[model samples]
Target: MKKRTRINVLLAEQPIGETVVVKGWVKSFRNNQFISLNDGSCFDSLQIVVDRDDVEEKILKQITPGAALGVKGKLIESRGKGQSVEIDAEDVIVYGPANPETYPLQPKKHSKEFLREIAHLRFRTNTFGAIFRIRHAISYAIHQFFNEQKFYYLHTPIITASDAEGAGEMFRVTTLDLDNTPKTEDGKIDFKKDFFERETHLTVSGQLEAELGALALGQVYTFGPTFRAENSNTSRHLAEFWMVEPEVAFADLEENMDLAEKMLKYIITYTLVNCSQDLQFLNDQLEKEESQKPKNERSAMSLLDRLQFCVDYDFARITYTEAIDILKKSKPNKKKKFNYIIEEWGADLQSEHERYLVEKHFKKPVILYDYPKNIKAFYMKVNEDGKTVRAMDILFPGIGEIIGGSQREENIDILLDRMKEMNIPEEELYWYLDIRKYGSCPHSGYGLGFERMVQFVTGMGNIRDVIPFPRTPGNAAF
Candidate 1:
């Protein structure tokens, strides 16, 4: 016979009366007669019925929780209330032993903090298994949504000289010897002796390079890992994360918003249809988690309902100035509840403001556009008012500002002037300017932080819980 049939396949196929091989780690053993086994194939575990008379007591004692087991069994209709089928073991083999005293994972509820420390072993748990499975479904949905629209998936560079975000928070990639570094006569560190011959770092965003492809190929998107060296230890921030950036030629800010809204809906709907079981499990888990909180602190809607709410209603659209006006008159700003007071039109919005707009005021996703140019990047198109840019940010209920992007300034003269005002060297971005120099038409793009989206969709409180191996300020443990 084949090595073993995965529990997911066995549960779905239900090949009754046939002798099959099942191999997995034991979740629980009840009375030495019923064994619950999980193989990471699905969130549900397979129940293995062991006849106490057939198996020796010494061998049966080894089948403790976390022990690896292989069993030759026959599938039959289960008499259990919840499950439909189970395996009747004929023979059993212990692949490994997990002593109850030594094993870190006990057959009980473990805190997420504890699980984070043991991330390598956390995948075996039902909650994490459901999260990752849903993550996979969302990732596939992203590619499918773009592919259906004839968008080319662009692979942007992982290392480059340009600081795409212009934020100066980057992890340097240098091979120079720190102990005996080379210096010029001016006492400046000589980058000529470095590996790239100039300063280079891990990419912060792939939007710039994706634009190059979009201008040539008509439409393109880049989904890849991005790095940030900010020393933020908060639950909302990560040192390293994944991003999905899509660029389109001959498109404006309105078209970009439309694309983003459609894409989000598609992914949410796809997960609901394809990963129903996982979503249901996560929904129940979230409900139990929230039940412990104060009544006022609990979420108004469930996980599945929140997802469906996103798909059901259109995102509210407003200008940054309009949002400021709304906030300035709101109770939070008037009562001095906002951390950052909304007294001026050009002040940047904070998380509290964003949450109020999404969760309390509008009670839906909101897209705030035409932000002040000084608050946005240099690439955004300058509005007719000269003080604002064609920048847009999509704010979600739990996750603030999930997507941020703008229409590119296609005019070569304006682009160069903005670069000069921002003190960005023209020579370094010669390739980027060339796109505007030759046959430049209107183009727009936006970037979505993948992990933040996962947190929003899964109702996960901490961003670290959504990603498999979260890289935080002082934590990189596998």
Candidate 2:
């Protein structure tokens, strides 16, 4: 058997004159003499200079844009303006050759919409490659931050019977045929013969499970896929999106905010430090596409740089009542015009309100807690005031609500009462309530959309473009 090639052993700068062997799919053939080969090594492909005499005629002819090759070469300096070190190929072995005609990706540019269709091959593109690399790095950074802080990594169940958030956004899992669905004598459908012996669906958030574990472990986090059946065809919504929710026991709203802010800052910082090449490629891709790009976004090399500035700077923290006051005041004397006019209370905040507080008024990240009781989650702790609950949503400059968290209603009476009020069946959440009954702690957690982070970091316009295999409304093509 042939020995496996040690890919990504040395970076271009590390060994300028030393020989290296890399196996990767060819990104592009820059010229007849130059081939951009990225061997799963780094975010950006290393440019390899190929001489006409050095490579075989048949071998050289077959090296297409997406062809996979194992190349043994010496790292040399490049005359190219965009990059630094280039490789001088000694031997080129073709492992896989992607047909250029049928290959979804080529040298030409493609739209985010176009890329979403060929989601399988989207990662080979520069934009998605960078975005995915950042996604991976960001995820690891989440684990790193929490793990180092001695937080237990919790794996919340995927198939759950309870709706943690009473948002009416769950995709029910059934084994019944729609053509001949089972029904009871009375007009009710029978769920007993269905999957799991009862009604069940995908979990929207792991906050409840995380809470149970956190109460025992003190600090716990759940990083997994969350499903929402809402047919939202926007740049931000995905039918199935990964969520990173960390629940802390015996922690207040202030402490929760601090942990979240620190975690965000850490993730950004880690990605910047770890994946520099990937980020630069993403930045260039964004600049090429967007003409009227946000000035703040252009300057950021890594998301962490922005987060570091965020943590160092004071975040704008105000009550829902205070925000209402500010919004109402703005109506009388408008300093700047807002797209969505905000001059009210009792209603849910529009994107305009969130943007105003985070992007305009604060000029920094704003943690908007103490939301109206009617608009917020039922499990959230009722604030000192009668009408509002201690539910906070972290809003960033670019994205409106990146993180949504709240102090859980630890009091069993209030929780059960709220559940009853919301019409959530008590029988379904027997295990969840057991956590409250056995040993309850003042726990809190936040759900962060993973694809949203990818969008934020890579500056991608669509959420579908960021995820590898996006499960959108009626589009699940492999």
Candidate 3:
């Protein structure tokens, strides 16, 4: 029983004339003499050459697309033009056979909508394989970036009684039977009898818990799954996604911005160096996709160029007030082209506005800080002018807000007033307020939606494509 070598390693090592064992699913069986095999190790597939005359008819018949096979072969220089090296199979073992008549995936192009329906099997496709590989690289870069900065990785609770974003869009975690639900004396559904003994929901963000860790430990980060119950069925929204949040004590808004900018550049640069092949494939994929669009709708820069731009240039920084003023006078708003028209000073910016700031006005990544107090969360530090908060959002070219953060309010009196004004109950988050009472300093943190980052890096248009088993509105299949 010879050990199998991954295609990626074999491709890189190029063990020419050496007998190697490889096991993978057959991507295609062409001309009964070649097998395009892949094991999802990388974007490229190994061409396995078969001797039609020597191979058994039954074994050859089983080499259909999607069939799993183990092959003992000699690695040699490829005779074909597409690949550099190939395998000359000496022995073939069929682990499983996929019937060509019933197999959903064939050797052809499939629509993204169709692929979403069969997401469990979509990973075998080249496009998704590249996406997921780059996804892994980006994820690794995130941890490595933080670890090098001496930040502690903290595991935050998935279920909590408090909503950190104050967005009121959270999935409730309950063990109570809904068919015959428990009720209180006032006829309201009683959550006190539930599993946690009170109301608790799947956490929408782990920033609050990470903040606690930061206040005590000086610096900390959390990487975990977060859920939202928002019914947004858009290209950018997801019901469940991963988040990367870093919190630093004794840090102000400027330090927070620096941390975010540095981290993003590091991650992008790491991916460019470590995952060059996968990035190139995805870049070509985006180029092909963009070619189908109208000339006016095409992106000015390619995917690789856009990523390099992020790493090469400094992110343009401006206050939220300045951003609002720019948007108000921009041709999109003045000419009635924006979907959400920016008509006032206090209005929240939409994705279109953010994209404009990045792609048109700044021509690079943009950071807009000091948001209006009323539109932001309750925990942000109130500015001296009393009308705004020390909040910031990092906007990218294709994606709107990739990261949103704030200098947390350490003053218990101000925090309580903001919470009350925002209708956030203090009793619900008493422990959060207690941190301020004890020894809270000027702590700041930001959350990067891991899937959104993956989407941005991989040039994926739909957020659903980047995440495996995407949990979107009304669609949780596999």
> Could you give candidate 2's per-residue lDDT for residues 372-451 as a string of tens digits?
98888888988777688878888876777888898888888888988888998888788778888988878787888777
Any runs in candidate 3 off by more than 4 Å, and if so which? none
Query: Which model scores highest in lDDT?
Result: 3
| lDDT (Cα) of model 1 | 0.92
Candidate 2 regions with alpha-carbon error over 4 angstroms: 1-8, 16-19, 77-84, 287-308, 331-340
Residue pairs with backbone overlap in model 2: 268-304, 269-304
**TM-score of candidate 2 versus the correct structure, residues matched by position:** 0.91
Superior candidate under TM-score, 1 versus 2: 1
Clashing pairs in 1: none
**Per-residue alpha-carbon lDDT of candidate 1 for residues 1-478, written as tens digits (9 for 90 to 100):** 3689999999999999989999999999998799999988888899999998888888898999899999998999997866899989999899898998888888899999999999988887888888999899899999999999999999999898999978999999999999999999999999999998998999999999999999999999999999999999887999999999999999999999999999999999999998889889989989998999999999999999999999999999999999999999999899998888899888989989999999989999999999999888999999888999999999999988999999999999988888888988899999999999889999999999999999988888899999999998888887
Over 99-163, each residue of candidate 3 has an lDDT whose tens digit, in order, gives 99999999999999999999999999988988888889999999999999999999999999998
What value does the lDDT take at residue 85 in candidate 3?
A: 95
Decoy 1 TM-score against native: 0.98
TM-score, prediction 3: 0.98
